[model samples]
Target: MADRKEQDALIQQPDAEAEAEPEPEPEQLTGCGASALCDPRRKPHRFLVLMLMCSLSFGSYFCYDIPAALQTQIKQDMKVNSAQFMQLYAWYSWPNVILCFIGGFLIDRIFGIRLGTIIFSCFVVVGQVLFSFGALLNKYWLMEAARFVFGIGGESLAVAQNTYAVLWFKGRELNLVFGLQLSMARLGSTVNMNIMGPVYDAVERYIGVESYYCLGITFFIGGVTCLFSLACGLILGYLDKRAERILHRKSHGTEKVIKLSDVRYFPLSLWMIVMVCVFYYVAVFPFIGLGKVFFEEKFDFSPTHASAVNSIVYILSAPLSPFFGLIVDLVGKNLMWVLLAVSTTLGSHCLLAFTFWNPWIAMVIMGCSYSMLACSLWPLVAFVVEPHQLGTAYGCMQSIQNLGLAVVSLGSGAILDMSGYFMLELFFCACLCVALIFALLLYLINLFQGGKLNLSTRERRKLEDQSRS
Candidate 1:
C-alpha cells in the first residue's frame, strides 16, 4: 500500500509541474514577415513611414513661405512697407521662441510624437484659415495674429518631425533620412514660390490686381495643403501605434520623467552648435523671406523672373539635399562639411553683393551649400544628446534660432528699406562669417572630444562594436 501511494504522488507531482510551467511566447517577427510590405521592420514599411513623416510638414512649409512667395502682392495689396511686410515673418517667429520649446517638452512629457504631430498640424490649418479671412477682411492685425498662431504650430511641428526622424532611423539611414526630409520641405517651399505667384495672378483676374481679397483667395489654396498634411499625420499615428504594439518598441520615451535640470548636463559642444544654428540660419532664412523683392530690384528681373530666381535655392535643395546627405553619411567629417558649406555660402553672398554675375550662378551655389549644411548640421544634435533628451535639446536649438530670426528679420527689413539690398547682403555675409567662426570652435571642441561627430558610418559602427566588446 505504501509503494502504491508513492507512485500516485509522483504522478501527481509531474502533472502539477507541467501545469505550472509557462508556455513559450510565439515567435516575434524581426524582418520581412508574411507580408513584407506590411511588416513595420521591413524597408518598404520604413520607407512609407519616412514619406509620411516628411510630408507631415509640407503644408506648414508651404504656407510659411506664402508671404515670401507673394511678397509683391501681400505688401502691395495690404498697403504695408518693407518693414511691415517683414512683420509677417517676425510675427511667425516671435511666439515660437517659447512655444516651440514647450511643444518639444510636451512631445517628450505629455503627448507622444503621434498626438503631438496631429495637434500641431491642426494649429496650422486653423491659423491659415484665419489668415485667409484676415486678408479677405483686409485686417493687417488679424493677419499678423493668424501668422502668430500659424507659427506656433509650424515650428513645433518641425521639432516633432525631427524627433520622429531620430526615433526610427537613429543609426540606420539617419543622414539620408534627414536629407530626404529637407528635400520634401524644400519641395514644398519651391512649389509655393513657383505656384503662388501664378495662383495670385489667376485670382487677380477675378478679384482684380492689388486686392486683398485676391491675396486671401490665394492663401486659402495653401490651406488645402495643410489639410493634406493633417491627414498624413493621422495615418502616421495609426501606423506608429500598430508598430509599437507589434514590435514592443520601448525606445519611444523613458519611464523616468524629464527634468529641466537635464539641460545643465548637456555638453558645451551642443551650445556652440546652437549658436551656429542661430547665426547660419539667420543669414539664410531672412534672406529668403525677403529675397523676391531683392531679386526684382537688383537684377532688373520681372516679377515672374524674380520669383524663379528667388526659388532657385529651394529648387536646388529639393533634388540635391538627399544626395548630399548620402555623401555626408558615406564620407563623415560632418564638421568639415559644415565649414565648407558656410564658406561657400559666404562666397555666394559676396558674389551677389559685390559682383554683377548672373544671379542664377550665385543662387545655385547657395542652394547646394544650403543642402549640405542642412544634412550635416541638424544631425549633430542627435549625436551629442541622449535619446530621451532629444526633444529638449532640439527645442532649445530651434527656440534660440527663432529668436535670432525674429530680430534679424526685422533688422534685415530695416536695412533693406534704409540702406539697400547690397547692404542687406553685406549683413548676411557678416552673419555667415560669425557662424564660420563658431563652426571652427565646434571643430576644435569635437576634435578634443574624440571626433565622434565627424566619423563616417563604418567607423562609427566599428567603434560602437569595439566599445560593446
Candidate 2:
C-alpha cells in the first residue's frame, strides 16, 4: 500500500510541474516564431521604420518649400517686391531660431515625444489656417505672422524627427539614418516643385487666375498632411511606451535618468565644427530660399524654369548624401567630409561669381556644392554631441544656423531693394568665403587638439591616466 501511494505521488509531481510553468507572452511567442522580430536594442526592422519616419518628415517639410514655389504668385497678388518676397522666407526662419532651443528643452525635460508631436502638429494646422486666410485676403502682416508661428512648429518637428531616429537607430546605422532623413527633406523640396505648378494651374482653371484660392487650397492640404503625421506619431508613442514597460519588467527597475550636462565635455574642436556648420549654412540656406528668383532675374528665365533649375540642387543632393555618409563611415574620419564640403562650396561660389554668362554651368556647380555641404554637415552632428544631448545640441546648432539664414535673408533683401538688382549672387559668394575661412579654422582647431575631433571613452580615460602620470 505504501509503495502504491509513493508511486502515485511521484506521478502527480510531474503533472504539477508542467502546470506551474508559465505560458510565453504573445510578443515573445510571435517574435520567436517569426524571423522579423525586432530586438529593441539590436537592429530590427529599422530600415522600414526609417522609411516611415522619413516620409513623415518629408510631409512636414513640404510646408517649408511651398512658400518659395508660391513666391511669384504671392508677389503678383500682394503687390510686393522681391525684398518683401524675401522677407516671407526670413519670417519662416527667425522664429525657428528663437524657439528651437525651447522646443528641444521641452522635448527633453517635459514632454516625451507623444504630447510634443501632437501640440506641434496643432501649431502647424493653426499656422496654415492663418496663412491661407492671409493669402485669400491679401493681408501681408497676417501672412508674416502665420509664417513666424509655423517656424516654431517646424523647428519642433525637426527635433522630434531627429530624436525618433536616434532612439530607434544607434551606432552602426545612425549616420545612414541621418543621411536618409536629409534626403527625404530634399525630396519635400522636389515634391514642392512637382506639385506647386500643377496645383496652381488647376486652381486657376477652376476659379480664375485672379482668385488667390490656390494658396488656401495648398495650405489646407498641408494641414491635412500634418494631421496624418500627428496620428502616426501618437501610434508610435504608444508602441514605444509599451516597449518601455516590457523592458522595465525584464530589467526589474534598473533604468537610470540620463544627465544633460554630461555632454558639455566635448572637445573644443567640435565647437569649431559647429561654428563651421553655422557659417556654411548661413552661406548656403538664404541662397536656397531665394535661388529661383536669383536665377529668374539674372538669367532671364521664367519662374517655372528657374524653379526647375533650382530643383536640380536638391535632386542631386538627395541621391549623393547617402553615398557621402557611407564614405564617412568607411573612412572613419569626418575631416575628409569637411574638406570635401569646403572645396565644393568654394568652387561653386567661384563659378557663380565668375561664370554668370553660362547659367547651366553655374547651376551644375551650385548643385554639386549644395550636395557636398549638406551631406558633410548633417552627419557630423552625431560625432560632435553626446547621444543623450543630441536633441538639444541639434536644436542649438539649428538655432545658430537659422540666425545666419535670417540675417542673410534680411540683409540681402535690403541689398536687393536698395540696389535695384539681385545682389544675392554676390552675397552668396561672400558668404561662401566666410564659410571657407571657418572651415580652415576648424581644421586648425583639430590639428591643435591632437588631430582628434572626438574621443572614445577608452581614449579619454587613457589621456586622463597619462595626465596623472
Q: List lDDT for all candidates, in order.
A: 0.86, 0.65
lDDT of 2 by residue, 338-385 (tens): 666777776776676666766666667666666656655665665556
Worst 10 residues of 2 by lDDT: 3-12
- Highest lDDT model number: 1
Strongest candidate by TM-score: 1
TM-score of 2: 0.83
Estimated TM-score for each candidate: 0.92, 0.83
Model 1 Cα lDDT, one tens digit per residue, 239-269: 8777765654432222345677888898999
Tell me model 2's lDDT, rounded to 2 decimals.
0.65
Clashes of each: 0, 0
Question: Model 2, which residues run further than 4 Å from truth?
Answer: 1-44, 246-267, 420-422, 451-469
Sequence-dependent TM-score of model 1: 0.92
